[model samples]
Target: MTTTTQERPTGTTTEHVDVLIVGAGISGIGAAHHLKERFPGRSFVILDALDARGGTWWTHRYPGVRSDSDLFTFGYRFKPWRGASIATSEEILSYLDEVIADDGLAERIRYRHRVTTASWSSAEHRWTVEGTREDTGESVRLTTDFLWMCQGYYDHDRPYRPQWPGLDRFGGAVVHPQQWPADLETTGKRVVVIGSGATAATLVPALADTAAHVTMLQRSPTFFFARPKTHELAETLRALDVPDDWTHEILRRAYIAEGDEITRMSFEQPDELRELLIESMRPQLPEGFDIDKHFNPSYRPWQQRLALLPDGDMFTAIREGKASVVTDTVDTFTETGIRTSSGEELAADVVVTATGFDLSVFGGVSFAVDGQPVDFPSRVTWRGLMISGVPNMAYVFGYFRASWTLRADLVSEFVCRLLARMQERGATTVVPTLRPQDADMPLRPWAVPENFNSGYVMRSADRMFKQGDREPWIHLREYAEERTALPALDLDDDSLVYR
Candidate 1:
């Protein structure tokens, strides 16, 4: 592992490293830790386009921004979360800071480095990565033996904003939660938040506190699990003087088990699971609150990610008359507010669009393999870690149903193991290849719509890589299965070719 800066003739400086980890978010941090701990001889650097380490957590500053999943699983496997199950953006950032400080990862990260392109040279067995330093506006270049992408799946720069009729004619301020204004005043303001996903669920209840009235307007209903912010087991364990490490492992496994059960129920008995979820919310709402119309969704549970309403705060807001839910289509944006298709007008001074984000493939960086532009959709995923025909590269795309960090940890271990194997084989490059038996396997969309069809995913389906029907060629978003399978994977298998 070596690192040296060289002045290039083109006015850009080039540096070389053993590994180049993109995105200094949770996944990248965990990857860096694993690489340093397992292979201290290797040198690496983490590059993030943002100025901070926490990717989504750093970018999203909307009121009441918090994790939809519990911290036990959402937090890194090696780290113990001492806070409540649901953590706010500030708390999450503090936790990430601890990870960086404790692991000595702060110096290895290059913030404000936006990677623009990655060109892989098969003959050279390396990737030439090019980017610009956002702070200085200087062109930056780097070459690496391996590339690890943990930039996440969304385009942080561009949130999905639906062009509604008469949007330009609206009299008041229209704000997207992604790019929340720091100086925007909501106190005593009539706020109408659009969309029914986790963002809306989080924003409405929060804005209702100061806003004169807040309404969450949605086209359709989405599944939400109203859960307590604190975990009883975690509290009990801490009360009993259990060690943090022990508590963390126990709670992590416990949550994974519960999540696995829910996932199974979603596939095997969706209707039953759906009823259970909705019924749980019924008691929290006012009597005869029209649960069938607002709480119940047409789709089955887990088909899309479920939002977690910590302590049922959203329902409490509604019951307290501070916030309300309106299930209807927006006919158009009126001068003051919005008019529903049912001819009802919602008067608001501020409109918050909590609509979802746009999916970004490989951080929207262009890729070239042997000087030929690589088409992601034309390739297939290998165990959901590495893409076929892409050499010495692995990405972190975590579980949608469970905490994302679970798979990030797993992928870190897998990559370390693969790197060690490559060293033993004296191989400079390794890429996934189709086995003889896999040649005729049917290729499907990265995520099957029936399995998990979030709006952002459906909108970007054509840009994602394909998955095969067989082993070593599919991404089984099951943490339980991947936890065991990834570490025990046979590196000598023919699915991977080493040179």
Candidate 2:
């Protein structure tokens, strides 16, 4: 790898590196480790739009912000998460901090530097990345041989806020979970959390402890799976004097097995699964609680992502009269609180919009190939990592049904393998291209409409890449299947162009 440091008249510096990994999130940090392990000779840098390292964990510091999945499965394969099964934002951020410090990645992270546009040059076999520094608004440019997008699929700058009528007239402070204030005064305040997704589920229980009352206002219900905060397997392994890494691997596998079973049962026996979930949660509530109205969703299980309710905290809060669920539509926002369509007015000191995320593919970055804009909707995803027709680019997209890092680890491994093969063949560029028959293959939205029905996904599925029905074209969300298939995938397949 060669480095070129040039001083422009505008006081901007243009640097060249072998790889440019965007976003210093869990995926980007993992990608850095993999690159360093596999291709030590290569020079790379991680660019993050935020000033901090942990992406989502750093951004979302709201009450009860934590991972929905277990830490073992969500963590990197190379590292063992020696913490509770479900970790908080602080724990997750600290884990990432350890990863960065241990791997000497702190010096490599370009924090506050956001990449706004990426254009590929076929002749030079490089990508020209352009962006502005968040703090200074100064232009920054990076030329790299490859681009790895670990920025995630959602926009962190803004949360998805619906245009509720009379929202402006509300007397209370309206806040979104994404842009949570550090010194948010919720104590003794009647808080109304809007939406029934993961954020809402988490915020309601947490705010209930101190707030006068927490009301989860949802138009529709979401399927929630109760999980224990602790894991017996880890404790048992510790008693056996097993190494942390060994114990972590075992727990990770166990979580994967559990997730797989849940996914399978949801697809094959959705009704049975739904009923089982309802029965499990019913006992956690007080007598005469309207389970059907508050917990019952119109869609089947796994249609939308299940909110992992760790240790029945949400249920306990509701049962204790600290928090309550309001299943109704917002007719409008009253001066004091929200007025439901049923004429029930909720009075609140603060209203928290625990709404879904704004889907921003490529971190809202512009892309062009040889001066022509690369239309993402027209492209197909290859193995759920790289986009077809986009040269020397790969993204870390995790499984929706399982842990995020499980698929992230696999994608990093695949990229390393691909890099190794390229080095062996003296190849400078690699891109996934469709064969003649692939053109005939039916093109569906990246997130299949029938498979995934999450509000955030449904809102932005059309702008994303398409996935085909056949091999090398489709992206499977199954970790067990991907683990068996990804490593053995033929690098020389007609779909991939290596040169």
Say which candidate scores most in lDDT: 1
CA lDDT, every model vs. true structure: 0.93, 0.90
Tens digit per residue, CA lDDT, model 1, 322-415? 9999999999998999999999999989999998998899999999999899999999999999999999999999898888999999999999
| Stretch of 10 with least lDDT, candidate 1 | 476-485
Model 2: per-residue lDDT, tens digit, 92-183? 99999999989899988999998999999999999999998999988899899999999987989878999999999999999999999998
TM-score of each: 0.98, 0.97
TM-score of 2: 0.97
TM-score computed on alpha carbons, candidate 1: 0.98
Model 1, residue 130: C-alpha shift (Å): 0.4
lDDT for 445 in candidate 2 is 82
